[model samples]
Target: MNGNIRKNIRIGATVDVVLKKDQPTGRLTRGQVARILTGSATHPHGIKVQLQSGQVGRVKVIVEEAPSE
Candidate 1:
């Protein structure tokens, strides 16, 4: 299951960061999923996504490409 998910993921997929507390005030920026760090000693649930601009932050929100009908 894990391997399948990793294979399906797009390394250069676009992502946006939204603060969990403040939704409106926090603006979203363009980023890509650098690596999938999950189920580790530090992060138990969420994934850590790194941006192109060298800004690393936790994945607060993830917006995948919507399916085209």
Candidate 2:
């Protein structure tokens, strides 16, 4: 699933994101989501979130979407 939708990302969901500094390089960092930072339903650049690894970045792709509640 795509990461553009905020609803697709859950607190414990695993996703791939591009760190602020890595956007130009398209570097993808994989980790479980720690928190959802974006309040919007969707974002053109994908939702921004804090990873379990304490890394904050905009989601690039959702490796594994959290199950719907």
Alpha-carbon TM-score of each model against the true structure: 0.43, 0.91
lDDT of 1 at 13: 58
Give all candidates' CA lDDT scores.
Answer: 0.49, 0.91
Runs with alpha carbons beyond 4 Å of true place in candidate 1: 1-9, 18-28, 37-45, 65-69
Report the number of the highest-lDDT candidate: 2
- Per-residue lDDT of model 1, residues 1-69, tens digit only: 111233333456566644344445765565766655444434432355556666654554456742335
Q: After superposition, how far is residue 48 of candidate 1 from its true place, in Å?
A: 1.2
Q: Provide backbone clash counts, one per model.
A: 0, 0
lDDT of 2 by residue, 18-53 (tens): 999998999999999999999999999989999999
Which 10-residue span in candidate 2 carries the lowest summed lDDT? 60-69
